[model samples]
Target: ALLKEMHAAGFEPNAATYNALLGDALQVGDFDQAWHIVDVMETTGPGIDFYTISILFKGYKGKRHSMDAASFDRTLGLIQTYSVKVDEVLVNVALEACVSLRDPHRLSATLATFKQCGWTLPKQCAMHTYATLIKAYGQTRQLDHAWKLWSEVTERKGLTPSEQLYGQMIDVLVTNNRLDDALQLFEEMKDVHGEHLDSQGFAVAYAMIIKGYAQQKECTKALQCYDQMKEHGTRLGLVVFNSLIDACSRVGDMDAAARLFR
Candidate 1:
């Protein structure tokens, strides 16, 4: 209605005005309306810019399940179609979408497309970006790729790994049945960032390691990890507690299992 009023008043809405409307649509999860705005912009109003592409990508971040390959490809096609100069923010949003989608093929294709568009992945990105890429690789069972990325970040001069990054790497390692590696990394993390272990973020990593050990029937090791977690004052959630109980039952330690159950 407001747009109609503007049109009747002989006021032209530029790309920024349309971009704001598109953002509002996306914010309300009105993807249909957002696309309509994009279509109108493409046909009559100001052409799409990098911000437009970024907004679209950000909008899809939460609605990744609705984003199929065709939709993703069309979004990518816009960059070439409009000669949109990809910026770091846009690249990060793309990476996030790839992570949320958990499609390795799409992730690989996106990176390849970015390369073709002359934006190479930097040796170092924001730690959250690295964590998201690591998770995408991990979810796709690309353990080596995930590990290689972890090593790259650690080896970067003077760049301390964020706690979130460590948690992600630990998760990848634990999920891959590399409990020993995960434990070593956990210990290293404790030594470096021990004071911060009490945070709930690290608690999830601890739970992963405990669950890994439990799955392997290494109940004793699982219990040891639980003890360490307690020692570090990490919050024990139901997942960890349940893993400990199961680990005890697996080892025929009914007494311990009963104690954990309580």
Candidate 2:
């Protein structure tokens, strides 16, 4: 009715006006109405832009709290159907929703759609997006895929992998009982991105390594990692120190444990 009145008044609704109407429709869970507004926008010129895409994505995200998995997917379907272009931001939004839902099938489908749309993964894809996908793959025990994405993000894309990503990769390797690979990646992170790392980041990496070695009952290597952490001037947290002491105790090196405790 409002749109009808606006059209009758010779007031041609632009994208903003249409977006406003879309928001109102989505607010009430009227996805059909929302898509209709999007259709109007596309047909009337001033077609959907990034901002419009963002608004639609955000609306789906907001609705997820109350919507079931099927409903969430339907709302997202509208974006895929109506999106003018699938840029990195839009892809991130879709991936994010999939992650939150833990929908691996949806993730695979979204990537397939991304390719079908002739959208290559943007070189400037944000690190968080890479991290999220890596994590999603890791959780599914697809370690190879995780590492491939990591390499592309850091090497081909030339984006510096964050300490969080490094830590996540180390944890994934360690969890999968690939201790040697974990150690290698641990050292590689420090070597390749050492200058980019802060003390806390180094601490996180060292703690993961120390915990990994300790879990494997390799007290000597765990101690080596602890010493390395100190040498790097990383502020060791109490949890890491406890892990080191536990490693010593596990190896019946009470003297070393006592020294650490003191």
Candidate 3:
């Protein structure tokens, strides 16, 4: 109705105007309405731009779990059908959707499409981008690919890995059951990036290691990690406490579990 009013008022709606409506629809999870807008944009003038593509991908940001393959494919199809010029923001949004969906094939396809559209990681690309790609590979159980990206980021001259990057790498290693490797990287991250991490960062990094130990039934190591975490002034959270309690219970140490509970 507002669009009709705009037309009646001689105010022609362009890509930006439609992009706003598209963003609003996607933000509210009104994908049907969003798609209808996309259809209108297709039949109208002022065709889709990179911003339009980015907005479309952004709709799937936190809603990837509810997204189906067909929806994903349809969005990807837009890029080709409109020949949308790819940009870093658009590429990142698409990559994130692929990661959230845990679809390695689509992840690879997205990367390829970005390359075909002349998008490449800049020399000073954000560490978070590499971190996201590493996580995507990790989710797909492509450990080698994850490690390669990690090495690329770490080996880059004068580019320090962010705490989030370190955490994501550690998480990938631990999730792959490579506890020893995760621990080694954790130590490296502490030596280099520890001063930069706040109490919350310390808690998160320590939590991952502690939980990894607990999952392996190494209750002693988990407790030792908790001790170290406390020494770092990180207030213990419920996750850490629960993992410790479960670890103690798993080892048939009710007494230890009671002590932790207390």
Instruction: Note the residue pairs that clash in candidate 1.
Output: none
Tens-digit lDDT track for model 2 on 105-190?
Answer: 77677667767767875666767777766766765678898989988977777776788788878877876678899898887888
Distance from true location, Cα of 108 in model 2, Å: 1.9
Q: What is the TM-score of each candidate against the true structure?
A: 0.83, 0.59, 0.84
lDDT of 1 by residue, 1-262 (tens): 6678989999999989999999898888887898889898999989999989998888777654455566567788899899898766788787776666667687888777777889855754788878877887787788998988887887745577888888889888887888889889988888888888888778988898888888788888888888877888899999898998888888888787777646
Greater TM-score among 1 and 3 belongs to 3
Clashes of each: 0, 0, 0
- Write the candidate numbers in order of decreasing lDDT: 1, 3, 2
Candidate 3, residues 90-180: lDDT per residue as tens digits?
A: 7677777777677778877877777787777677777778887778778778899898878778675546777888888988898889999
In candidate 1, which residue ranges exceed 4 Å CA deviation?
60-73, 237-261
